[model samples]
Target: MAFLGFESKVFMAPMAGITDAPWRTILAACGAGNLISEMAAINAIQRKNPKSWQIANVKDEPYPVVVQLVGNNPELFADAAKLVTDLGAYSIDINMGCPVKKIVNNHAGSALMCDLPLAAQIIEATIKATPLKVSVKFRKGWDNEHINAVEFAKMCENSGASYITVHGRTRAQGYAGVADWNIIGEVKSAVKIPVVGNGDIDSPQKAEQMLQQYEVDGVMLGRAMLGNPWLLHRTHHYLQTGEILSEPNASQIRQMLLKHLHLLVNYYGEHSGMAISRKHIGWYVKSMYDAKRFREQYTKLNTLSAAQDLINEYFLRIEA
Candidate 1:
């Protein structure tokens, strides 16, 4: 259950556009057990795509970072695994759980769930290519009609995957409906290696529930951590003390948002950083009063100063 030397069992999921180096560094400081990089396309990496390199960058993280790669080609996966390892990745995670249409159509991601033999071959190739521990993240199945997580977990374990993570839904379900924790439990029962449960776990209580009820070795959070890195800290604290902490107040949330903006600007440069900050800004104000108007105003931001000014104005209005 050791997660490449992480101290906690609450992990940040490898969300494609969200869990980049800047955000991972923030979560690590908040005591996230493990921080995974955004999904890196293996073909893009092999082609020396600059955007792929940017997303895969893990240089500043304090903890050993886990880089997740998505692709169906075994040779390309092997090559990408080695590249990330050379760039200082602590582990390589195969992306069999991504449900995006583009990825699935490419015969990658959740599509791999339909072809267990190829998935196993990819795992074996990546493991053989790198001395780093390799893992696989997959869904319950391709659809409700094909519930093969238990069988897939066994294949990954037998194929030399160090551990496995299972999202509770199938590809057909996408992010809709409730994630079936019972299926995660089934995978846990079917595998001897560590099993991490992902999906629908957004709070400390939910995290504890997954561990106590589903018996997973760990829990991975994705959408839940979008603008609430404090959830990671709160989950860890609750696990240690059996007491839930108060949610971050308006002031605290504002400060976190400001810090997030600064980090994004530092990492991605001002223009692109401000562009990317739009969605995060919206997430931060999602629960606030008149948030729709604020979001409409925020997405028009084209400069860092303009974004900062708008954020200050928004917080002032909340305080008023």
Candidate 2:
């Protein structure tokens, strides 16, 4: 099945606050399937918020960028779709997968899963507003007791969703426990629309396994790609050659981390970017030599220079 008119089959999931422009560019460069921008708030966009507009813009991105929007109001969601499509997104995705309190309390996000009819309304309205292809990312249901991915996938297809992404956990699960791939397979079986399976795809082997076992149209990698952009390239290579790609050495990992920090600094400025990089710093240093000590020191670093120094020192110790 074609995605946003492209034949590519892998996607970097629209991870809120994580899949930024730099991340999209790096993943696209490494042969990631069509890139998905992080989710933008429909309410923020409808209010003409500057931050929301910037977050949705993707005109200069290298790969086909599919913009994801989150909101409860059908009309507002439709308007946001038009706005992002105007900004040159190849497609627009509705976020019915987020389980955050702010979004769910507003009847947006995975809360829509609790009401499939309204979820269909949102999809219908968004599809009518823009010529760009539309997709929806949703959880199994509000909880295990309310599992309805099959029913929800059908509703999305009937309402004109061009594709569907099923995150196997429910709203109540919230990244806890193992993702039940069986639910994702069930959703794929229930829908004629292209189904992309997401959740727990942390390694290239797991990616290939998901593709082989579920027969999904695509695999979307989320949290696993953090501080590991090479996963995109490695997964793509393994898919094509049937051989596992070697993992990056500690030095290589450190370099990637530094590159990411530089890009983030360029995109968000030093102060804001450094704060954001802290989360990634923690991820990159894990399991490496002196990682715990480096993490402790890095957490206290407020300047880019200090962070760079700490990284250099940590790697130096590893080499020594």
By TM-score, who's the top model here?
1
lDDT of 1 by residue, 46-130 (tens): 8889999877767656687889999999999999988888877888899999899899999999999899999989999999999
Model 2 spans > 4 angstroms off: 1-4
Which sections of candidate 1 miss by over 4 Å? 1-4
Which lDDT values do the candidates have, in the order given?
0.88, 0.85
User: Candidate 1 clashing pairs?
Assistant: none
Candidate 1, TM-score vs. the true structure? 0.96
TM-score of each: 0.96, 0.95
Candidate closest to the true structure, highest lDDT = 1
Worst 10 residues of 2 by lDDT: 1-10
Task: Please estimate how well model 2 matches the true structure, expressed as its whole-model Cα lDDT.
Answer: 0.85
